[model samples]
Target: MKSILVIHHGQGVGGGLIALLGLIAELKENNRVHVLSIFDGIAVDYIRQTGATVTVAKSRFYAKFYQLFIHSDAAYFNIIDSIRNNKSVILYYLSKYYFAGKELKNIVFDYEIVYLNSIFISDWARASKLAKKKVVIHVREPLSRGLFKFKYEIIRQTINKYCDQVIAISHDNASRLDLQHKTTVVYDPVVTKNRSQSEYKLINRKFKYFVYLGGMARIKGFEQLVESLEYLDENIRIFFLGGESEYASHGLKRLVRQNLDPFFLKNKRLIDKLKKSGKIIHVGLVDDVFYYYENSIAAICPFSKPHASLPILEAFSVGKPVIVSDVKGMEELVDSTNGVFFINSDPESLAHKINEMSQVTEQDYEAMRTACMTKYKQIRERSDSVTSVLNRT
Candidate 1:
């Protein structure tokens, strides 16, 4: 059995973390797998539950610095704030390098491969190469835009120069980077058993609610979703399944304020109305996502960015349709058969799509639900097996 070290950026309950968990579960059947997480959250416990040894390398300084660098709108202020708040960032890097080097020295003789689960931790890839082990870099996020584009470019260059293989979650993500020759596209796996119509009805008996899952980031279109609530009918309710804490909700508001899109600002009154009406329920970070999926009418993903979303796949796995933004990676996943696509960042368009979904006849809805199952099977069939990608000859 091959011994592998998988280093990940965060333990947040997002697509990347979920995908990593699926991979870990598969890999542990034969290989000796150990996980190193840079940040701790719900995902850490999930990883541990899968029987993989998990190590958390805590660095508040690095975390704060990275957050500020990426999310803060004012570049100058962000740099200043990062310096002021994370004075230990430099020391943290030095300590990380030292610890990583020490860890490599201890395990280099035994571990055959080191897998960098996210591009944010490219340092691990470099360290793994230095230890003369095969380095596999997984580019899960679209890195061509946003504040860390330069850092992502560096990672792409590093992968091109030193890493043995690069895995991208989607073709769009792969096309955006420069490591095409060594890159392999591996869609995240979905394994949900089929449930009978009676079972689905029992779970979905209460409310005809739509669900939104994932981080409440601006790029994920949280603000747009909030804005669209005003245009939605009062009978239409939405359950937000992620964003675990009050801090996360507050931080989302802060980001909205910072990156206030003109369309969102224009529909600010509707946002206020939805807040007061309580139509949008925030069911923060529940352990069982299937409960939310089984109960909801459909899944909604109004992301403005261009990355493949896990919620879309999760919705399909549970035999539910999705209403996603018509953006690059996201649009590639949904078509008229399984789900509806709204124009990206346009609150009115989202509102229209939500209305359209509400009006779907029982017959049409059943057809869409069947399409979701078929699409899920097609995706699973097209995806390269995680084992084949990791255990490459």
Candidate 2:
């Protein structure tokens, strides 16, 4: 059996998890496959659940430890901040062993293949390129996250120079590749839950509410979603189902709650106050997302800036209408007849689109649902397999 390795940087929490699971199912019987990534990974859980022999180099502190010693100087700056805000020194030391254990994995990685997940590595200094063998770089992000600051562009360019291929998830991203000869378009393989028709929690058919799933990032259009709620005609309630601020776009739900403080008063006051006023129903973070989508009339992706998002496609698979930002990446999957597209980051436009679609008859709603279902199947075919790509490489 041909032995292979798949490297992943923690990116889209669900999409990445889905892709890895699908890949293992497809590749395992055909060849021996190995996976290397940080600990507490979604991929690691899926692998363990499937009874596969994969490896994890993660712990609560390992990621930070790796950054401090093995990652780039720029990465170390952030690590120092995390360390200074130290809960404990022994905790930091315990976690930094990513370098100690897996640092030499590339040496014995000799059954044959290598796969790098995105261009997130600054440890290219330590690992040697497999010149005789082909390498695949999976492209999930639009560009390098901290490429310039960490001099990762030099590493990316070196990867471009030495790696055999780069696999991008969308055609729009693939077509613009700087390294045309080595570039390939492999649409992300999205595996969705089979929706049961009878399960929709249409508590009030006429009383419509929309759901937005994922993080509360500015790029995700949470600010515009709140603004759209203000312009809305009060009949349709807007619901946001997501976790709050990890970075710049974090704390938005709190900001919204603070802004509306004068309007109400109660013990569990902030979120409850908003829900009572019917401005925004903050669903908080959920474990099983299908439960929320099945009940919602429409699912939303209102990004202030456009990048391909997984939730919009997931909404389609669950047979719900999607109202999303009309930007390049977001607009690519939508069909006007299947779903509605609104002006990006404009609350009034988002609200208008919601009002228009939420009023559709049950039969009409089902037709749009059917059309979206058709689109989801097409993506699975069009996107090439990562293992298949590596096998060809």
Best by lDDT: 1
Q: Which ranges in model 2 have alpha carbons more than 4 Å from their true place?
A: 10-12, 39-47, 58-62, 65-102, 106-110, 122-128, 131-133, 144-155, 193-202, 247-284, 361-367
- Per-model TM-score on C-alpha atoms: 0.80, 0.72
Question: CA RMSD for every model?
Answer: 5.3, 7.3
- Among all windows of 10 consecutive residues in model 2, the one with the lowest summed lDDT is 68-77
lDDT of 1 by residue, 175-273 (tens): 877678888888887633221123223233344588887545556777688778778876777877666222223567557544643434434554465
Show pairs that collide, candidate 2.
39-58, 62-95, 65-96, 245-250
The local distance difference test score of model 1 is 0.70
* Residue 44 of model 2, lDDT score: 66
Give the poorly placed runs of model 1, Cα more than 4 Å off: 40-42, 58-99, 106-109, 145-152, 191-207, 244-275
Residue pairs in clash, model 1: none
Q: What lDDT does the true structure give each of the candidates? A: 0.70, 0.61
